[model samples]
Structure formats: structure tokens, C-alpha cells
Target chain A: MKQNRTMVVIFLTPALLLFFAIFVYPIARTVMMSLFSVENVTSSVSEWTFTGFKNYADLAQTSLFRKSMWNIFRIWAVGGLVVMSLALLFAVILNSGIRFKKFFRAVIYLPNIISAVALATMWLQYVYAPRWGFLTDFFSWLGLEDLAATQWTAAGNKFWALTFAYCFGMVGYHMLIFSSGIEKIPHEFYEASSIDGASKPRQFTNITLPLLKGVVKTNITMWTITSVGFFVWSQLFSTVTTDLDTITPMVYLYLQVFSTGNTVMEREAGLGAAVGVTLGLLVVLVFVLTNLLIREDEIEY
Target chain B: MSTAKREALYRSRQLNWRKEARLLPGYALLILWVIFTTILIGWVAAASLSTTRAIYRGEVFDFAKNGLNFGNYVKGWNSQNVSVFFMNSLGYASVSTVLLVLVAAPAAYVLSRFKFFLNHPIQNGFVVAMGVPVVMIILPLFAVVTQLQLLKQTYTIRLLMVVLYVGINVPYTTIFLLSFFSNLPRSYEEAAAIDGCPPMRTFWKIMLPLAQPGIVTVSIFNFINIWNEYFMSLIFANQDATRPVAVGLYSMINSMKYTGDWAGMFASVMILFMPTFILYLFLSEKIIAGVTGAGVKG
Candidate 1:
């Protein structure tokens, strides 16, 4: 085929130009901005004071920033475990010759399509409501009246509630990934294992787990991306703008750069950039680490 | 009938009681999950049609005692400015999704077809861009947009919003359609070319329409994403008339303390999500396949 350079240029220019404007330029500037002390988000590059690494140092010392970091780390670690296990379990079950697989899969993935704000509202307003909440009603019906009276929105409990809701919404996506991977595995592996009298659980460990190594890495990377961008859930779950219990780094960044929330008094835009840089670094680091750890041993069928 | 489905149907016809019994626990777990999902959305639906008093009184489901009321939707739509929010999102989502396809498809087609030096690098760049968080580039984007003063008026902000939405999703859309275009048999273009059609004409007349299924799938996906987008709109759109539903709903909820219209609030949430929810209802299988197939770049 003859190469049409003009045609390629014409087609690619729009997307390439927009990508540079939207992604490339901003990313480059953000890296620069994180190295400087700036007053506001709208401040010109001319107004920036060169303060190499100080913004990061300030964030490191700042209690709220540290707290937000800790909060997101927990979300990544603990929520990762809960989401992965449930997603894998559901995926295995759904792939195991179930009836109405599409219906169940759709229902599970329903929350992912809806607005996060709306989903969070449902959890905050109804499911976690103290009076007449779903948990309360269920517990009371089961004769656990004292357990039914628990205040889910209280300081101690809000984080778990938030994590639980977030995990529930996320399980569908990871499950679909796992299920696809599971489906791609040769049925003969399972059939032969069963013929050898291996139980289902043993088959899952020996065949399914080993085969899903790439899919597992994909899930973890996707999970990491979502966890790092955990903003809406934290904001919806928080009672205040600066709710220490629920504030992730994203909320912290929003407060520092955009909102006049009480969390940051100085409102240093540089600090926000630093937070972004830290998060971007974390994503890259995790990608690198996952790649290094889960080196794909390609197995051709 | 397909062999797989036929085989499964045949198996299902026979009373595989032992196999069914073995899978009882899986069925129970799936049923429990589906039931929870049903009740979660069901309660919200009931609350949307009930009065605040009924909701607070724990009788939203007691329809006989408290008849279903639709005044909440009316109030939410008319008085709470949800109408503006809904229209903004509808406009933004529809326009951006179309433009996204238009912009992404050509690029994807070219990248998939051509043997250019920049092909792999460009594709890799877009893939990397997918993982780049919004917070990373937001400050500079804000600075540049504000410096250009695009946020001054309602229409400009709306235009800016659409442009931003399209820009954000261009990478994912391109990557998704890249694979779709690659998988397309090149024989279509070759046939058209041999029939005296130019290369570009072949793409427009022959290939683009062939890629319609992928385009529609990704367009729906983009539509839902733009409709539910929050952080960017919250920052950029700043005004009442220009705010999309996600930001609009957030503001409404934030002000619920003073308004105290819990029923109206729930109604607005329904309005926010109903479009995407309805889309999923009719197109879940397509949307799910889109996600698991080539939707989210690994």
C-alpha cells in the first residue's frame, strides 16, 4: 500500500493538536509549576517564584496533606483487597455456567454507569441513614436491634462506609476484567483437572490464578488509577469541607487550588501541583513495580 | 442456533440436578448481590416519589398510606434549577460525544492503516495519557483557560466545557477505535481504491460506516462519561446556567441544609442519572463488552 503522508497529516493533526493542548502542555507545565511557589491557580508563569522542591517539602510537613496521603494509601491497600476478592469471587461464579449471566453482570456493573455523586448520595442519604436506613432496617428485622441503632455516619464508621460503597461500585469493573480473563482460559485445563478429581477450589488456584497473571496486573493498575483519583466519594462522604476522616489527596488538592475550604489557609497553588506530582509519580511507580513484579510469561494456547 | 448456545441449552434441558446442586452456593451469592442492587436503586426510586415527611418517617415504601407524589420532580425541575443543569449536561454530552467520534475515528483510522514513524509513539502517548490524572494537568489548563477568559459568559463556558470533555476522552476513544480499525479487513479500502475511489473517499464512504458499531458503542460510553463528569465542570463552568448535572447535583445537595427538600433532592439525582441508567438498560451488553473488550486500555 502506498503511504499517503498528506492524508495521514490531515487526519492526525486535530487529535494530536488537542492532545498536546489538553494533556502534553498541561503535564509539562504542572511539572514545572510543582517546582515553584505560586499564589493562585490562575497565576501566570511570570508570577511563580522558583522554590525547587520546597512545595513538596511543605506538603510533606503539612499535617492535612500527610493525613490525606495516609487516607488514600489505606483506600488503595485495604479497599484493593476487598474489591479484588469480591470481584474475583463474582467473576468465577458468573463464569461457572450460571443462568442469566448477562442480567447479573449488568446489575453488578450498574453502579459504574451512574454518576458518582448520585451513587454516593444514595449511600449517604438512604443506605447509611441512621433512621430507616437499609442496614438498620435489616438488622432490626433480624432481631439485632442494638446493632441496628449504629450511627454509620459517625466519625469512626464513615471511612469504612465510604470504602464499602466505593468498593461495591468498583467490583463490577474488576469482575468484568477477571471474568474475561477467566473466559479466555482453555476449558480443557479445568476439564482435565476435574477428571483427575480436583475440586473446584483447587482448580481455581492451580489453573485460574496462574492464567490470570496479566489480568491481575491490569486490575491492580486500574484499581490504583481509580484510588489515586478518589475525590468524589471522599467529598460526598465528608460532613465538612475539611473532614479529616474522609479527605483524600484529591480533596486536599481541590481545596488548596480551587475551593476556599478551611483546610488550606494560604491556598498555595504550588502545593496543589505538588500533590498532583506526587500522585502522578505514585501511578508511574506502581506501573513500573507491577511490570517488574508481574513479568508476563506468555503462554500460547 | 449457535453451537455453544445450543449445547448449553441442551445441557440445561436435561435435569442436571447434581451439577445444579453443586452450584447452589454460587447462585445464592449472585442472587444476594442482585437483590441488594435492586433494593438500593428501588428505595431511591421510592424516595424520589415520596414526601420528605414520609421519607423521614420511614414509610417511603408504604404507598397505601402515602400515595406516590410527583410534585417533587416538578419542584426539582422548575424551582431548583435542575432543568438548567439537565439541559446543560444533555447538550454537552451529546455534542462532545459526536465531536469525539469525529475527531477520534479519523485519527484511529490513519494510525491503524499507515506505516508512519510516529505511529507507535503517538499510540503510546495516547495510552499513557489515559492514566494521567486530571489533577495533574488541571492547574495549567485552568490558568490557560482563565487567561483566555473563556469562563466569562454562559455560552463560552459551555463551549469550553464541551471542548474540554472531548479533549479529555480523545485518547481513550482513539485507542479503542484503533484496535477496531486494525481488526477491520483492509480489503474494504483496497476494493474501493481499485474501483477508482480515492484513499480518503474510501475511508469516508466505505470504512467509516463499517466502523459504525464500534463508533456507536464508544459514543454511548463517552456520552455517559461526559454526563457524569464532575471535577472539571465544577471548576470550569462555575455558573448556575452552565453547570452540568454532576456539579449541579453536588451544589443542590450542598444547599439541602437550607432547602430541606429531601424528596426534591432525590428527584434531581434521578434526573442526573436517568439518561445513562436508561442507556445501560437497553445497551448493557454492548456497554459491558465495550468495557471488557477494548474500552479501557490496559
Candidate 2:
């Protein structure tokens, strides 16, 4: 048997071409574009004027940019905690000899399939509707008039509401990951531990958590990537363009470059590129950090 | 029938009381979650079928008075240009899904079979590209397209959207199929080669049909993704005539909110999601199996 060079080359050319055009070339250009001032997004290569790190400096000084940064950090940290714990809990429960497993899993994962726009609208328009909202209805039914009357999509609770809704949609995907991870661990470990008089919680801590180290890393990295690209939920959540409560970095970037009436005067194209690079850096940084943190050896089954 | 029922009728005889008691908390939590989920989407479904006036009056579920308003769907489909968005998405998603398989399957098969010098590097690059946020690559792609004046014309913009959709997914599709192709027994290829069948023909005739199950599962995932994709479509197809349902529905919802046509708004929400919703209804089991079994981490 021989390696067919011509066949390999012929087969791989189309994929390789797409990869270079889409991922390789664009990423390289974006990183370079971030360092310079471009006349416009459509500006040709010759129009780019070098202004090293000025875009970064400008972003640091801009308060809206700063606020967007703060908002996304909260979303990542707080929302991450909520989604991970809930996903883990649901996964554990589903794997615990429960009936209706298939039905529960499918229904729980339902929100992920729907467009985020539609899902967010269901939250903002109905769940958070001041007049006949789900929250108001439920609370009023329980005889808590004050809680029912409280506005949910209003500024005070709007950010947390956005976070909550986003977390709700995200849990199912991560739950599937954790569920599959739990299923991979042989039942014999639990059986032996139980025979030795270990409690369920003890078995979980001693066996499941350590065994799931790689999955935890995968989930964290994925969570960070999705968090960085957060846009549609925040966009649909806010009425005004610059709603301070829910403005994420992606939304800010869109407003800066893609939308009209942007406040930044010099070159929003550069600023947008800078924002992208900053986000790309965040993903890489977190990936590196999580790898260092979750350094358990992969145990073979 | 009565004896059969009576034989297993005793609650005490049929039940595992202590185990059931132990799992009671799990059931309670899950049931509460399920109930909440039901109320959330269920209310939205009900609201879509009632008039805005009834919705505001909190009479959506009071069907005895205000019966289902099927007219809301008509308004959503016709007046709002949802029909255009939906058709555009259907075109973009279906076309790109096919091209993704066509472009990716060959590369996947080659990489999985042949040990070329760049094979490992290419594989690693694609896996990393899967994790690369769209933000990183979008600006350059946008710039080049804008400079090329591709976004100006309707046809070119449509072509651009399809191309982008296919390109963005090429890595994922290729990587997914790589594992699928690798797992296939190589004896078929050997038998074909021994029979003097060329490598290329073998791939097309034998190996491809063999990989149909994997291709179908991954295609289902891809179809749902492209159908529901928002950010790229929002940027590229921002115009009234070209936008996908997700973005189209956003602008429609804004206007409808002002018009106070709440029923129409919810109805459009249904229109936006119905394709993928119906898709999942049939294939939820297959889709879930893919997610759990594979190393797909999107």
C-alpha cells in the first residue's frame, strides 16, 4: 500500500483553501488591523496608518468601553457559576437511575435549538412583562403583592434578568457534557464505594469530580468562548442602543463599527478591531489558565 | 384483564418504597424545572394565538371568550416580511449544509486515511479554529467583502452569505467527519484497491455511502446551527430584503412593540423558530446522541 499524494492533495485542497481564507487570513489581518488606524472598514491595505497600541490606549480611556468590559466580566463570572452548578446538578440527577430521562433531557435542551432572538423575546416580552408577566403572575398568586408589582425588565433588575435568562438557555448544553462525563465512569466504582459504606456525596466527591477534570476544562473553555461572543441576548434585552445595564463588548463593537451615529470620531474600525483582539486574548488567556488549574492526569477506564 | 390488573395492583408489591423515597427530592426538583419550562414557552405559544388586546387583558388562556386568533400568523407571514426572511434562511441553510458536506467529506476522508506531512498540523489547526470566536475573523472578512463591493448587490450579497456560511462551518464539518471516516473499517478500501478501483472512485462510490449515517447526523446539527445563526447574518444580511429570521424578527418585534401588536409579535416568534423546532421534535434523540458521544465542544 502506498500513500496517494495526488489523491490527498486533491481531497484536501478545498478544505485547506477555505481554512486559509476564512480563519488564517482573516485572523492575521484582524490582529494587524487592531494596531493601526483604518480610514474605514472598507479601507484598502494602503489606507491603514500605523498607530501602535493607540487603539488599546483609547479603549482603556473610554468609559463606555470600560463599562462594557465590566458588564461582560460579571456575565462570565456570575453566569458561569450559575450555569455550571445547575448543569452539574441536572446531569447528576438525570444519571441517578431516574425515569423519564429521555423526556427530561430533551425538554431541558429545547431552548438551545431555538434562535436566541426568539428565546430572548419570550423572556423580555412575556417573562419580564410588567403587566402580565410570568413573574408578576406567579408572585401575585402566592400572595406577594410587592414582589408581583416590582418591575423586572426595569434597569434595577434588568442586568440580572438578562444573565438569568442567558444562563437558563446555556445549562442544557453543559448538562449534556457533564451527563456524558458521568456516564463514562464505570458503575463498579460507585458499587464498591457503597459496599465500603461510603455515602453518595462522598462517592461523588472522591470519584466523579476528579474523573471529570478534562470535561471541566472543556466546559470552562467553551463557556468562555460563548461568553466572549455574547451579543444577541443583550441586543434584544435593551431598547436603547447604549443601555448600560446589558451592553456587552460585542454589542459595543457592533455599535462602534456597524451602526451609524457612533460617538467615536477618529476610527471606529480600529477600535472594533482592538475589541476583537482583546476578546481573542481573553479566550486564549482563560484556556491557558484553566489548563494550569485543572492539571489532573487523564485516567483510563 | 381484571385479573392481570389485580395481579400487579398492590402499591406495596409493585413499589420500591425506600429507593423511591430517596429519589423523591430529585423528582421534585426536576418536576419543578419542567413545570417552569412548560409555563414559559407554553404561555408564549398561547399568547401568539390571542389578540394583543386579550394578551394585555391577561385573557390569553381564556379561550372560551377569545378563541384562537389564527389571523396573527397571517399578519406575521405577510405584513412583516417574515416570509422573505424564512425563505432566505431556508435557502442559505440548506444550500450551505450540502456544500459543507461536499467540501468537508473529502478532506476528512483524506486526513483520516493518508499520513501526509501536514496532516497533523491541519487537524490541529481546524480544532483550534473551532474555538476561535467569530469576532476574531469577522472584521477582515467584512472589510474585504465591503471593499470588493460584494454587499451592494442583492445577488452578490446572497452569494457572499452562502459562501461565508459554508466557510465558517468547513472546519467543524471536516473535523467531525474526520473521526467518522477514521472509525470506518479500511478493508473495503483495500478490497476496492485490490480489484483495481481507483482511490477517488472508491471514496465516491463505496466509502461515502458507508459514512452516510455520520454525515446525516452532522448535517442535522449543521442545518439547525445555520438556521439559528444570528451574529454573522445580522452583520452581513442587515437589509430588509436579505435578513434571516433572527435579525428580521428583531426589527419586526421593535416595530410591533411600538404598534402594540403583541399577538403578531409572538406569532412571528413562532415563525422564526418553527423550522428548527420541528426539526428537533423528530431528531432530538439523534442530535443528543451526537453531542454526548462526540468531542464536539461548541
Candidate 3:
């Protein structure tokens, strides 16, 4: 028993130390930094003037910051709904005894494995580009030439375009989740439903869906948290239509800190920390809310 | 009477055919969606292979006029720093995966096998950490890295990345392996203990081999997540020689105004996806199992 305690300490120390250094300490510093105002580009004085709640106050008043907060909700609402619906649909189709099930699954999942940058680029060049992209040409060939010329990633269409892109990239992964959930359902359930003269639609609505509640909850939680934490993809693609400052809150903060060329200014640091903390709190709130809504229940197969 | 009965049976068969016909529209919609997806993917592949002139001419579908060539691939490979980018990704992902498994396996074993004062709280903490945003952690990490002067060298940055990856990944890996380890029958270990084999020896020889599937699943996940990670790599390793393919591709795209090499950019994107695509083709079952299996069970 003594040896076991020693073993636990030995095993856990490295991970705990690294976590404290990388995860815990940095968060503490961010909160502290958010309380100060920048004095210079390189360094700040130890004479810390604690501006109580001013940073948060400033953030609330900024239009760009407010728009970013709204944009986060818009993206999550539209993108999350579409992705989940498509995932459920595909899961049902794939779960139905289809030919080439594995091939279909692989094709659907291909986008998930590709890097986010690559996936975004592929969408921009092939599907959403206005002039020479395939979708444009296809529409033009169908005599909707003007519609074909509509810029997809332009400011006018950016929100829908971004949402679709997010959904398309995410559907395969969530579909795979739902499909596995469906696979676990016993064949007897379907057989009994059919014996009782229940139609396919009825069976799906009643048995398949309720059985999949757990998987759905998991996917929703994942999507919500990840969407709130989103920085890279939004920055990569939306920057085309949106201002560098008008992207997601996280990207907005990132640009403030890192986009300065060569001159390390500390002014943006405090503001950036303020933005980061706000975004973090928002994400945590969403996670907690979602967790509360998604109550745990065991489904017997 | 016999002729009438035969006619009635044939009528019932006709009604059944009509019932099956009602399912056709759903199937048709699925097929149509698949076709659309295929066209999009094919167009991207063709764009990657075409010359800039062909692309400008809007002859994307005219494969006969614009045959495939490796020129774009060569240009992309050279211009995008694909060589260095690929190496950096490989090193970071491989090193992180190895260390994650090494730390997580033993930790998971102890948590599952032994009862401790803080076991439940530790488990809960890991679950909570899973939801913590990477953005929340990045600011602090950036501050820490700068203070440590670890950002000055590529090797040091990579080492820090490995440690960070392992640290964050611990919660998931430990929880994952915990279930597997605990599901293991305790009788085997008890017998080994009675036979005078030390606990460590039993773990190395008996439990490790038994928990191979869980280890493989978790390791694969760690590998994929690290490989696909863009944000951390973007901030920490933005320098050209150390950038991973994801960040490298982004920089290449961002430089298009200066370079005007869209074909080269697309080609590199295709190349960057190759490893992941191939892995998906071969081991999709495992990937699916790892993701959905882990989530549902947890």
C-alpha cells in the first residue's frame, strides 16, 4: 500500500507539473494582466494600478467586440443545427443495410481527417469561388449565369458560406458517431417493430431516435464547446470577408497581440488578455449550460 | 376457385411493390447528396493538377485539353516549405503520441488498480479539463513560453509542445485506459502477486499486453489530434522552418497576393491531406471505433 502511494506520486508528478506550468499558471497570469494598463512596448512597471472592471467595461462598449459575440452565437446556432441534422440523416441512411457501407463511410469521413486549412482551401477554390470554380460553372451551364457569379465568401454571403463550410467539414465526424450508436441497437428491436406492422419512418422516429439520445447529447456538447473555442478556421476563411478585427473574439485577440510587426507593444497585451478572458468565460458558460441540459441517462440496448 | 385465389395473391404482390416504391425518394436524396459531394472533391483534385493558365481560362472540367502535370506539385512542395512543414508535424505528433502513451498508461493503471484519496476528484478534474478551451490556455502558455525563453529554439519549442500535448491529453487518455484497465480481471494480478512477481513486473508483463487495444486506440487519437492541431502550432511555431503543414499552407495562401501561385497552393493542400487520407482509408474502422466508441462508453 505504501508502495502504491509512492507509485501514484511518481506517475503523476510529471503530468501535474507540466499542467500547472502550461495550463494553470498561464490562466492566472492572464487574469492578472487583464487588470493592468500597458505602459510601454517592451515592459511595464511594478506600480500596478488596478483598473477595477474597466477592461470588461471597455469590451462591452466596443462594437467590434459586440459583433464578434453575436457572430459566435449565429455561427453556433446555424452551423450546429445543420451539422447535427445532416449527421442524423446520414447515420440513418448508412445504418440501413446499404451496399458499399464501408466505402460510403470512408468517403463521408475523408474531410474530417484532412487538415482544417486544407479543407477550407478546398472549399474556397472548388465549391465557393465565383469565377472559375466548379459550382460556378455548373450553375452557369444551367443558365443561372448571374447566380453563378455570386461571390460566396464575400461579405454579403460570408455568414451562410462559413456556416455551410463548418457543417460540411463536421458532418462526417458526427455522422460516424451517430452511426456507431445506431449499430449498437439490437436487431430484435427492428424485427419486433416490423412484426407489429410499424413503418420505417415510424420505427426511426420512435425507436432509433430515442435510442440515440445519448449520442446526440455527446455530439451536441462537443460541437458547442468546440465551436466556442474555434479560432483557426474562422480566422483562415472569414478574414476574406470580415475585417481582421471583426473575426471571432479569439481571433480578434490573437491579431491584437501577434499581428504587430516586430515591435512588441504591451498596450495590446492587456486588451488582448481582456478579450481572451471574456471569450474563455463565455465558452465555459456555454459548456456548463449545455452540460446541465444534457442530463445523463443510460439506454439499455 | 383456384384461379381466383391465384389472382388474389398476385394482387397482394402488386400492392407490396407499391409500398416499397414509397421508400425510393429518401434513397434518391441520399444518392443525389453523394453525387454532389463527389463532384466537389473531384473538382478540387483537378484544380490541384491543372496549370495556372488552365485555371484562369476556366477550363476546370476540360481534362482532355488540360492534362494532369506534376509541375504544380513541384512548385507547391518547394514554395510552401512542405518539406520542413511535414517534418515538424511528424516530429511533434510522433513525440507527443509516444509520451502521452508512456505517461498515461502507468497513470491509468494506478488509478484503476488502486484506491486513493483523490481518485474520483482527479477523474472529475480530467473531465472538466476536456471542455477547457484551447484559447483560454494559449495566452497563459504564450506568457510562460516567453518567460522561459523556450521559444528561441525549434527543439525546445517542440519539446514544450510534446509536454503540453501529453499534459492536456492525460485526462482523456487516463480516463479511456482506466475503464479498460479496471475491466481487466483482478484475479490475474492477485495470482501474480501470490507467485512472488512484483506489481511492476506483473504490470509490465501481464496487464500491458492485455490493455493493448485501449492503448492503440488512445495513441491513434493522440496522433491524429496532434497532427491536425493548427492554433497552437500557429502561435508557437510560426517561423518558417518550424511551421507544421497546416500553418504552412495558411501562410502560403496568405502570400498568394505576392506570389500569385494558386495552383501551387492547391497542390500543397492536396499533399498535406495525403497522410491523413491514407490513414483514413486503411484504418477508418479504428478511427471510428476510437471516437464513437470512446464517447458512447464514457
Highest-scoring model, TM-score: 1
Docking class of 1: medium
Candidate 1's DockQ is 0.76
Number of backbone collisions per candidate:
0, 0, 1
Ranking by lDDT: 1, 2, 3
- Expressed as tens digits, the lDDT of each residue in A195-230 for candidate 2 is 999999998899989988888988999899999999
**Mind sharing the TM-score for model 1?**
0.97
In model 3, which regions exceed 4 Å deviation? A31-48, A238-246, A261-268, A291-301, B1-23, B60-67, B295-298
Model 1 C-alpha lDDT per residue in residues B84-135, reported as the tens digit of each score: 8899999999999999998999999999999979999999999999999998
Candidate 1 lDDT over A50-152, as tens digits, reads: 9999999999999998999999999999999999999999999999988789899999999999899999999888899887699999999999988899999
TM-score of chain A of each: 0.97, 0.97, 0.86
Which digits, one per residue and each the tens of the lDDT, describe model 2 over residues B1-298? Answer: 6977777776445668787899999999989989998898888999999888899899899877989898999978988688999999998999999999999999999999998689999999998998899989989999888878888888888888989999998888888888999999999999999999999999999999999988988898999999999999989986778888888888999999998889999999888878998999999987787676454532
TM-score of each: 0.97, 0.96, 0.89
Q: What is candidate 2's DockQ? A: 0.68
Candidate 3 lDDT by residue in tens digits, A27-120: 7767777777643212333644678677778778777667777877787888888889988888888777655677777777777877888887
Assess candidate 3 and give its lDDT: 0.75
The local lDDT score (0 to 100) that residue A67 gets in candidate 1 is 94
Cα lDDT of model 3 by residue, B192-250, tens digit: 98999878888889998999988888787778888888878888885787888788878
